[model samples]
Target: MMYISELMTGAPTNERCPLERRMYETLDKLKIPYERVDNDPAASMEECAEVDKVLGTEIRKNVFLCNQKKTTFFLLVMPANKSFDTAAFSKKLGVSHMSFAPPEKMLKHLGTTPGSASVAGLLVDEDDYVQVIVDKEVAESEWFGCNPGINTSHLKFKTQDLLQKFLPKIHHRARIVDL
Candidate 1:
């Protein structure tokens, strides 16, 4: 059985990776209240369902993508259950030939590896290199759930806090796309 800790408010008491710690620090700095849980690394959306139960909200699916030239990078957050259609996403966004960004780029830009990417990663994107694309459904949801830059830990907070406070404070605006 998957091990999931009880729903707890705020950051972990013990040491965490720099990225994860930064996530909590940023949120706390912004006064954006959140709930979190520590669990085994969940590599897939299906596995996140268990964490969702504890969080009381579905975890959003965060994908790091780039254009063909890799010049234009994006961090897209969509409904966890929604399938990602790259072609359709590209069409909707008016970008061409969008593909999953390489792991190195994901690390360099988002500060997280595959299966561990989240909007929290945007806190490290100080240069505003990664364009944040949030699905309409996700943006409208009352609560947002995502990893704190690691799959082993997850966080849930008010969607308003993310859209209105977090992104703006980080100087990254969310481009809400219907997909």
Candidate 2:
């Protein structure tokens, strides 16, 4: 797929999707600079790799998870290639088990679909119910990339800014883990 700029008549700033718009608004409010790249709505990990190439950064896998009772929710960010060890994660979080959160909960809380879960959606999470977890390997990067609350658009920002400024503004905190 071609760059959004080449395929579209106007700039990405004029794109649709309330989630993406809200994320950009927050970035503007904080005076944080970011570069956004739009791609096909990738449906699988391989397709997401194409988006990663276009964005020139690795896209972290954003997983929406919940404990058995569903009282607690988590948004785990890790390297796309990393395998999620439920037992290890449960042990780390002190939970019995962590299963994938349903689509309804994901939409209600993160304002995103299964393939589009991203930290950027935290902009819409007024309750701040979801815990954000980042793999230490992914966190070590100087820059990090994630969806701009839409599957077709990805945003890249300095890792320090993302963890320090962007996440705090959205009332989200990151827990670095080896998983």
Candidate number achieving the greatest TM-score relative to the actual structure: 1
Show model 2 residue runs off by greater than 4 Å: 1-11
TM-score of each: 0.98, 0.91
Off by over 4 Å in 1: none
Give each model's whole-structure lDDT: 0.92, 0.81
Best by lDDT: 1
Model 2 Cα lDDT, one tens digit per residue, 1-179:
53342222212656579888888788778877777776767676677787677667788889899999888999999888988888889899888978999999999999888899999878767898899989999889988888788887777778888899999888888999886
What is the alpha-carbon lDDT for the whole of candidate 2? Answer: 0.81
For candidate 1, the per-residue lDDT at 11 reads: 79
Q: Report the poorest 10 consecutive residues by lDDT, candidate 2.
A: 2-11
lDDT of 1: 0.92
Model 1: per-residue Cα lDDT over 1-179, one tens digit each: 88999989977889899999999999999999999999998989999999999999999999899999999999999998899899999998889999999999999998888999998888878998899999999999899999999999999999999999999999999998888
Clash-forming residue pairs, model 1:
none
Clash pairs, model 2 backbone: none
Q: Number of clashing pairs, model 2?
A: 0
